[model samples]
Target: MSVSSRPDGRRNHPLSRPVDVLERRVRIGIVTVAVLGVPLAGAAAGGAAYEHDRAVAEAQRDQWRRTAAVVVSEVTPGMSRGDLAGDGKAGTAQVRWTAPDGRPATGVAPVPPDADPGDRTHIWVDRQGRVATAPLNDTGVWAGSLAVGVLGAATAAVAGVAAVAGVHCLCEHRRDRAWEREWDAVEPEWSRRPHQGG
Candidate 1:
């Protein structure tokens, strides 16, 4: 297309349609954020969260210890069902173990359903001798971090696409309204008939 002078004597480039220009600007913003900004931001945020979780896990590991405990009560099937049936079953049993302070401690802990009294099992306990879960390992931390990062990136991308689509719809609506107005103004002159009573 070639550039030509407008009716007001100003030059109008063939590519200078108002709707197209606005749409291009909107697309640029969306692409910049969705394609460029989102992933970087997600990585940073995920890294920070991962670091925090790792530090906590490290601290927990330092503050806790594993010990052998002897079951003092018969283990029975746990109440949980469905896909989470751990070991295909679970049980609560009273157990006895040597605490960090060298004294015997007793607590209720989860055990395999087949565990009998006097059966020995490994258990984690805090410094205060309370039963606790094991600390997250390095692999777990990395997996968690990756999941967060992916979720963040996906959410940002979706938001950006939705925003661009919304802008496009608005632009189309405005363009259509402008066309209707122009047509209303021109239709009378364009459709005028020759006078027959002259």
Candidate 2:
């Protein structure tokens, strides 16, 4: 409701209270960390995640092979689960294909529901020509890395905010105590009462 240009002279500086200055400095420090730390934390986390995912993808690529398979018979899911999985072609089908080692392979894979005999469908297989899940892809690695990066940034921001709040509360407590002590000493003098020993 009111403003004072002249600060109380009891403080170290005529311009401000010590607690106010300390609180301001703490707030600024926390804000700076939140701003600068988020990106740093995000990058560090993202880099680690990227390395881990890329390593996994490399391992999968080395271990799995994608080859074309000819649909020999259908093994449709009763509830349309297989066709709904959406790898372009779906519905389980008995298929024949060649492995990376040039060995003739026969396995069950997903194919179109209307797939007829001899329809070519791609499948992933191991060295033994057994049906296997598709190898991990670069897209998955990027997605995972990005998610980790976001989580890291969020963590940094929350830490920064918590730090600021803790310091603010501590500074407010100190300010209140200082004000109370100062008022106790000054209140009697202003009221023209003799100071009493506490």
| CA lDDT scores, all candidates in order | 0.78, 0.78
User: What does candidate 2's lDDT look like per residue over 52-166, in tens digits?
Assistant: 9889878877987777889888557432333222444556778898876787878667666778887787777777778876665777788889999999999999999889889
lDDT of 1 by residue, 5-60 (tens): 86878676785668867797789988987888798868976898799889988897
Q: Which stretches of candidate 1 lie over 4 Å from their true place?
A: 1-16, 74-92, 101-103, 112-114, 187-198
Candidate 2 clashing pairs? none
Query: What lDDT score is found at residue 20 in candidate 1?
Result: 68
Give the winner by TM-score. Answer: 1
Model 1: ten consecutive residues of lowest lDDT: 79-88
Q: For residue 177, what is the lDDT in candidate 1?
A: 87
Each prediction's TM-score versus the true structure = 0.72, 0.63
lDDT of 2 at 74: 56
In lDDT terms, how accurate is model 2?
0.78
